[model samples]
Target chain A: MAKPTSRADSSTASAATEAVLGRGAALRGRVQGHGNVRVEGKLEGDVAIDGCFAVAQGGEVVADVQAGSLDVDGALEGDVTVSGAVVVRAGARVVGVVRGATVSVEEGASFSGRIEAEFDMPPELGGKAAR
Target chain B: MAATVIAQGITIEGDLTADDEVVVQGTLRGKLSSRDRVSIDAGALVEADVTGASLSIGGQVTGNVTASDRVDLVAGGKLVGDVKAARLTIADGASFKGNVDMDV
Candidate 1:
């Protein structure tokens, strides 16, 4: 088993909490941090999350996003960068660029952008490269 | 307002827009915009550009943050990016590696 990390390491390894952007809210600018964040409203700018990032089906965002993992169940117009994976659900609209180790575009999902990435298996997932 | 905790079962990958009083307990990967206090609970994972009136972090996040008010880092929080806010507080147990641009 892997060695356990200290409280300091744990805190550094993980930050923030589950955040949600209620419906009807509108925003414009830059946002960056670590944690799980959800948007069900509207946004126009740049966003980066360290953990997981999700866009609710009713949410709409126009900007660039980077994160460890991504799940889109809403509408997004911009670029995406992910260290882990990107999952685009049905009825989702995405227009921009994306770079990630793994990307999953669900059926009925529309996408218009450039994709650049190389999948790399995690340390915990050794000898598992199914490309 | 509530305790912070971003459970791994949840994942968000897109842009986010929020209003007053927010507590993250899931995963958010995108741009975040808020008008009031934005909290990042422990176990929460976020990667996005952030904007809020005030911010309280307790999870893992990357990117920049621009707060009209102040930005606070609670214990068990990890942030890696730049910040633009009037005030920024990093708790002793908080982990952060980034730049700070105050007076914005």
Candidate 2:
């Protein structure tokens, strides 16, 4: 598989920022970003970020989240669009439409959705500024 | 002192902003903001805003959550909020709902 785009310059790890959906956190809206994202709480709406998105264990989501890639381990209810890969861990449950180039779901995981995918990360992540 | 642990069966209502470690195994209703580690134990129920340097969840939450360092949603956990964190890990048995921001 091709490498994913870097969210930060190789030299500056602090150049990155992440928004969290903490355990008991909740929101009802849409989100758009130029970076990565991780969901560990609960949400209801849409998400469009330029970087990767992760749904951790114990986390739950019900929205349409779009990002470069997605690594999920929990429960999700909605539609997802991943340009790169979508990894679903064991015991995770997902229900919706999914689009990605690479899709991997571990045993014990459950999913019910649509998927379409194919794309690789760029090489020069630390080279230019994206708007 | 030790961290604040909300043992199972306990519940609170209000926002939380702490400077030390905290563990929730009960229920909360409000906002939670911390400068240290925050943990939500299994069977816990939280309904508040959450913030911390590092966060770990193994329960249920219904609010907004922000972690500066890392956020981990362990198995059997349920979350409902917008997330912001540097590192995020969602393992098996987790459920969530919200928008996420991980700027790089």
Candidate 3:
């Protein structure tokens, strides 16, 4: 596809603006951005963002997600990779592998997925010694 | 107020649907559908089939458009697609190249 014309000023402003998928909206493709994003509806494609990503209470996602951080309060059925943290809030239902620096699930959240937290292995486990 | 905004510099590929208003200021491809108004702001670029209750264009759109109420092509807007609406308006400075169906 041809690239969109870039206006320097607009690009800068866009980097700081948050993208919101409104309450009843839905997206079925790839979304790539440099700013934070919030979803309150449905998304059926992969999402890659340089900033935080959130799924609101009524939102639903069925694709892979990658971001700086992730906060979910809705339904997600895809793998997630976050550099910072992953928080599944109350009433959220997620079903996929989750990889992050920290992963937490609220009391009322429903999650059925593998959680991968990156951590340095201690030398006693032959981690550093093996290396 | 538009509940969803595809802010400047963002790029979306595929389909988008909403129940409320939507404003686009960036690049979007595939399809766009809204139950309410849809606005394509100046400098924005959209290449998709768009459906909404009302539509106002101030940017560039390349595809088919279906508006239940009205369609307005504002000044400086450029559209290259078919339009279907009950009412249509094209500003003096707007550019359009498509077929129009007012549902007569």
Candidate 4:
């Protein structure tokens, strides 16, 4: 059998600005930084990052989040403000207000929140008057 | 592999509980508890009371530490709090300013 090398390579490829909250771990506090963070466990509190933030499957986060971008594949219950896009993947459960450049909720994802996205309309669509 | 890793450039302030090993390469302020080994890597800054099965510090820690196994302060490590463990070792070049209790 060929050795599984991709897993090892990907783990080593993680940059210094990347952090992981693995499964079986729980944190009740505030995480603030200029790096990306992936949550695979339980987090309760506040998260403020200048980079992307992701919540993996089986993960749970109950806190306000401010990030460059947000991706959820688990459970998130808090307001989120992102400078980039907010993607609620399948099987994800998200609640609270979401403010981002773009917000997309895929099928199978449960989201109950108001979305605030600012985008420019095309000229053919009545432009700003369409608002 | 450690389950929880606080990577560099990140700062966490609060309580952290884990059933598995934890590795810190960032800044943490609060309490840390783990059922397994804990490692404070070089360049990390920890200002919290730490409780673990075993601990190895190569960075700067400014709180009391309690370990069921052993505690090792490697070279370049700096600790400024009390230590309670069964076995403890402070390597040369490590700076320590705390009381040690071997539980004899």
For each candidate, what's the DockQ? Answer: 0.12, 0.04, 0.79, 0.78
Model 4 residue runs over 4 Å out of place are A1-17, A123-131
TM-score winner, 2 or 4: 4
lDDT of 2 by residue, B24-93 (tens): 7666676677678888888878888888898899888888788989989899888888888878888977
Chain A TM-score values, per prediction: 0.78, 0.76, 0.82, 0.81
Query: For all candidates, what are the clash counts?
Result: 62, 62, 0, 0
**lDDT of each residue in B16-88, candidate 4, tens digit only:** 9998999999999999999999999999999999999999999999999999999999999999999999999
**Candidate 4 at B49: error in angstroms?**
0.3
Model 3 misplaced stretches (Cα beyond 4 Å): A1-16, A122-131
Tens-digit lDDT track for model 1 on B39-101?
Answer: 877887888888888998998889898889999998989999998998999999999999999
Tell me each candidate's TM-score: 0.51, 0.47, 0.86, 0.89
Angstrom error of the Cα, residue B9, model 1: value is 19
The candidate that wins on TM-score is 4
The local distance difference test score of model 1 is 0.75
In angstroms, the error of model 2 at A4 is 17
Off by over 4 Å in 2: A1-16, A119-131, B1-104
State interface RMSD in Å for all models: 7.5, 13.6, 0.9, 1.0
Q: Name the candidate that leads on DockQ.
A: 3
Which is the leading candidate under lDDT? 4
Q: Model 2: per-residue lDDT, tens digit, A2-83?
A: 4544533521321234445556555455555455556666666677765677788987778788877888898888888888
TM-score of structure candidate 2: 0.47
